[model samples]
Target: MRFEKENWDVIIVGTGPAGACLAREISKQHKKVLLLEKGQADLSINIPRMLKNNEMMFIGNGKTLVRGIRSGGTSVLYYGTAYDPPEELFSKFGIDLASEVEELRRELPLAPLKDELIGPAAQKIRESAVSLGYAWEKLDKFIYQDMCTPGYFPFDAQWNATRYVNDAINSGAVLLTNSEVTKVIVNGKQAVGVEAIVQGERHKLFASQIVLSAGGLGTAQILQASKINKAGEGFFCDPITIVQGLAEGIEAGNEIPMAAGMMFKNEGFILTDLTLPKLVYQLFSFQALRPHRVWQHRRTIGIMVKVRDGIGGSIKRGKVHKVFSEADKLKMQQGESKAREILQHAGAKRLYSTVWTSAHPGGTARIGEVVDPNLKSEYDNLYVCDCSVIPTEWGLPPTLAVLALAKRLAKHLLLRSYHRR
Candidate 1:
C-alpha cells in the first residue's frame, strides 16, 4: 500500500455511532481526524426502499441474520430505540455514565411516541404486556420528532447514524467513504496505522490513535486480517425472533410506530414490537401464512423477543456462528411463550414465529479478552470502540452505550496526548 504523509491525530475505522461520536468530540479540539466508512454516504429516509435493496439496511447473513453495511452502518437500518446501558457492565469497565448522562440527554433525548403515531397493532401489543403483569414502557428514541409525522411510523422516528456522521464532518473531521480497512498496521507491538481499500485502490492511513468501530462482523474481519484471533470470540447479538399474530380491525398495510413500547423482563430478556419494513413484513407474512391460507390474515402484529443467553456467538471471517445452549433455548422458548400470551391478549387470532437473527452483536473483542480496561488492544494505540468491545451481553440496544464509551475513550486518549505534550 502506498503511504500518504497527511497524518491524523486519530483515525477511526467505522462511521457508526462510536466513531462518529469520537470524531465529533476530537474534532472539537481542532485535532485532525480521519473517519473511514466502508460504504456510500446515502441518508435516504425511505425505510421500505432501503430494506428492499439491502443497501442501508441490516440484512442478516443470507443464511440467518441481517447485518448492515453502509456509511451510517446499522443505525441507518435499526429500530431507533435509544436505550441506557446496563450500569453493571460500565462499572466493570470503570466507565461512569452518570458523568455523561446530562450531555447524552442533550444530544439524544427519549420521547414517547404519541398515541396518534402508534397504530392500533402496536397499541394492542402494549396492552397485552400490561395484562401479563410484565412492565411495558414507551421507548426513548433519538429522533428529530418534528420530522416524524403521524402515519409515517418508523420513518418519522428513526435517526440514522448519518446525523452523527454529518455532525462529525461539519465539526471538521475528514470522512472517507467506501473505504474498507483490510489490515491494522502494527509496528513491533505498537499500532501505527491501517491499510484500507478505497475504490479498489489500497491506501494507508497513519494516526496517533486508531479506533475500530467497524461493527461486530467488520471488526472481526479486520482483526483476523491482522492476525488478532481474540477479536471475534464471545460475540453476542441480541438474538431476536419476531412473532407475528393476526390482528382484527387493523389493516394489513397500515403503518405502525417502528417501536413504540418495550417489555423488559426480569429474566434479562426483552419483548418489544418488531416494527418491520414493508419487505420484512411481506416476508414474515409469507413465512407465517399456512400452506393454503396465505391471505387469511388481514392484519399482523410483530413482537420481538430478545433473549438473554448465557451462550453467545462468535464472528469468524465476517460470519456469525451462534451456539444456543439448552438453557438459552429454554429462555428463548419462555420469551416466545410470553410474547404469544401478549399477542393473544391483544386479540391476535393466529400466532407464528419467524427465524431468529441479531443486529446488535457485541463482545467479540471484549474487555480483558482482546482489549484492556482502557479499550486498548494488545498493540499500543490500537483501540476497539464499537459493540465488539463490550465485555458481556448487554441485553439491550447498545448505540447510546457505545457512544458514551467512545466519549470516555476519547477523553482518555486526549489525556494521554496531553501528558505527552
Candidate 2:
C-alpha cells in the first residue's frame, strides 16, 4: 500500500487528554502535528450515541471494563473529578510535574461543586459519613459551574479533552478521526511512522516523531504488534462497584454523580456519592435481578466503591484477560461494607452492590520498564504517554496526571527539535 504524502513533525495516536494536550502545545509552536483518533469526533450526548461509543471488554468472571472510544476518549464518560498527581510518585522516577499541574489549575475549570450544585443525595450521604467521623467532603471537579444549576448537571459543563483537540486544530494541527493505529513503522532501532486503518483502508503515515498515547490497552496492543513482547505483561484497572439503595422522598436521578467522597488511603479504596444516569441505573438494577427497583431510579441513592486492585493482567490479541486477586476482592468487600453503613445511616433501605467493573485500566506499558522516565520506548523518537505509563497502581482519576505528563513530554520534544535545528 502507498504511504500518506503529507509527512508530519509529530504523529500522535489517540486524541485522549494526553495526546490532545500534547498536540495543542506542539501545534501552538508551529509544528506540523497530526492527531489520529480511532473513534468518531461527534460529541453529542444521547443514549444511542453514548451506548455506541462505550466499548466493553470482559476481563474476569462477571467483571467488565468500559471505556469511551471517541475523539475525547474516556473523559467524555468520566465524572469530571480531578485529583492532583502524587508528587512523590513521580519524584522517585526522576520526573516532576509541579509546574504543569499548577499551570493546568489556572487553565482548567477545577474546583469543588458549590452547595447548591451538590445534590440532596450527596448532601445526605456526606452528612452521615461526616457524622461517623469519616471526613467525607466535596471532591474537586473539572466542571464549568456557570453552566450548571441546582441539582442538575449538564454534560457540556464537564471539561473534556475534546476542547483541547479543537484548540489543536485551530492552531494548525491536523485531526484524522476514525483512524485506528495498528503498529509503529520502525526502521531498525529508529521509529519512522505508523501503520493504521483509516476508514477501513490500510495506510502508512510518516512522521519524524511518533507518540503512542492510545490509552492503556490500545497502546499496549500496538506495542505488542510492533514486536514489543513485554508491553502487555501486567496492568491494573482500578476496580469499582456501586452500592445502591432506595431512599424514600430522595430524588437523585437527575443529579451529578460522584459529587462528594472521601478516600481511605490506608485501606486502598474510596467512597463517593454517585447518581447514575437513568439508563445506567436501570441496567445495573436489572443486572442484579431487581426488576421491581428499576422504576425507583429517582429515589435511588448510590455510593461508589473503588479499590486499588493488584496488577496482574495481559492484553493479548486486542482482548484483556485479568483476574482480580483475593486481596482485591477483600478490599472491595471492605469498601462495600463501609458504603452500606453510610447508606443505612442516611435512612436508605434494601441495599445492594452492583457487579465489579473498571473504568481506569492502566499500567501495562509502565515507566521504568517499557518506557523511561521521559516516556520514551526502546526505539528512537518513539514515546508512550497516557495511563499506561503510570508507574504504579492508581485508584484515582488520571486525567490531570496524564495531562501533566503530556505537557512535560511536549516540552522535551520541542527542546530536542530546537537543538537539532
Candidate 3:
C-alpha cells in the first residue's frame, strides 16, 4: 500500500470526529496522511431516507445498540447535540483541554437553539419538566442555522465530520472507504502498521504512527482482534430507553428533535423530547405493538432517558456481551417513571416505551488502565483517541468532546514526529 512509503506520516483508522479532526489538523503540516473508513463515503444525511432504505445504520444484537457506519461515522445520524465535557475526567489522564474546547466552540456552530426552532412538543416537555421542578433548558448544538431547515437533506445542515474529511483530502490526505482494519501490525510491543481487508482482499500498510478512532465498540473490537486480549473488557453502554406518548392537538412534522431537555444530573439520568420524522415515527410506533398509533405519527412525543450503567462487558467477534444489572434496571425504572409523568403533564396519553438501547458506548480501553495519558497503549506508536479512551461513565453526547480531545492527540503526534525528525 502507498501508506508503506516513508512519506506517509500517519494513518488514522476511522472517519469519525476524532480521526477526521486529526487528519485535517495533521494534513495542514503538509504531512502525508491516510484516513480509512470501514463504511461507504456516500452521504446519507437524510434521516427519513436512511430509515426507509435501512442502509448506513447498524443495529446489532436484537437492537441492543445502534451506530451509523458511513464516511462521517455516527455524526451523520447525530442531531448535533452539544455538551461540555467533564474536564475533570480527562484530568485523570493528566490532560487539560480547556483551550482546545474553547477553540472548537468558536470554530464550530455551537449555540442554544432559537425559540423558532423549538418544536411545540419540546416546549410542552420543557414546561412540564419545569412545572414538575426540574431545570429544563435548551441544549447547544453544532448546527448551521443559516442552512438548517426543518426537513432533511442529503448533505443536511448538520456539522458532520465529512466536512473535515473533505478539508483533509483537499490538503493532500488520502482517504480510503470500505477498508475495514482487522488488526494493528505490531513488532514486539511496537506498532509498525496495520492490516485491513478491502473488498475481500488483504492489504498491509506500514506507518510510523497509528491512531485508532474507530469509536468505542469499533475500537474495542479491533484491539481484541489484534491480540490485545484485555482490550474488550470493562466496557459500558449508558443503558437507555425512550418513553413515548401520543399527544392530542400536537403536530410535529417540521419539528427539530432533541432540542430541549432536563438534565437530572444527580438523579442519574436525562429526559429529552425526541421529535420524529413521520416515516420513522410510524415504524417505531408499529414495532412497539402500538400499530393503532401509526397514523398519529405527527402527534407522537417521546422522551428519552439514558442512565450510566456499570462498566462490565466483553466484546468478542464484534458483538458486545453485556446485560443490564439489577441496579441498572432500577435506574431505568426511575427514569421511565419521570418521563411518563412529564408526558402525562404535557397532555400526552397512551404512553409506551421502546426496548432499552444504547446510543453511546465507551470506556472499553481506558486512559489510565488500557492506555497512557498520551492515549498511547502498552505498545509504542499505538494511540487511541475515541470513546474507548474515556475512563468513566459519561451521560452526554461525545462529538464535541472527541473533536477537542483529538486536537490534543494531534499536537502530541506532531510534536513526536518533529522530535524524531
Best by TM-score: 2
lDDT of 2 by residue, 1-421 (tens): 2238988999999988999999999999999999989999867546556556546667878787877788988898788999899898899999999999999999999999989999888888999999998989889899999999996677899999999999999999998888999999999999999999998998999999999999899999999999988998989999989999989877778887888999898899989999988887887788788888889988989999999887897899987889999999999999999999999999999999888889878998999999999999999999998999998899899999999999999999999989989
The TM-score obtained by model 1 is 0.90
RMSD of 2: 1.5
lDDT tens per residue, model 1, 270-316: 87876566556666556555443344434667788887655365666
Clashes of each: 7, 0, 0
For each candidate, what is the lDDT?
0.74, 0.90, 0.81
Per-residue CA lDDT of candidate 3, range 1-421, in tens? Answer: 5444444689899998889999999999989899988888866456555554333233444555656667888787777888888878788667898999998988898897787777778888988988988878899978887775444322456688999999999999999888889999999999988888865678888888999989888898888877877787877777667888878787765677788887777767777888766666776666677788888777778898888777876777865677667887788899999999999998898899977667667888888888888899988999999888988877778888889889999999999999997
Of the candidates numbered 1 and 3, which has the greater lDDT value? 3
Q: Estimate each model's TM-score.
A: 0.90, 0.97, 0.93
**Weakest 10 consecutive residues, lDDT, candidate 1?**
54-63
- RMSD in order of candidates: 3.2, 1.5, 2.6
The predicted structure with the larger lDDT, 2 or 3, is: 2
**Error of model 2, residue 227, in angstroms:** 1.3
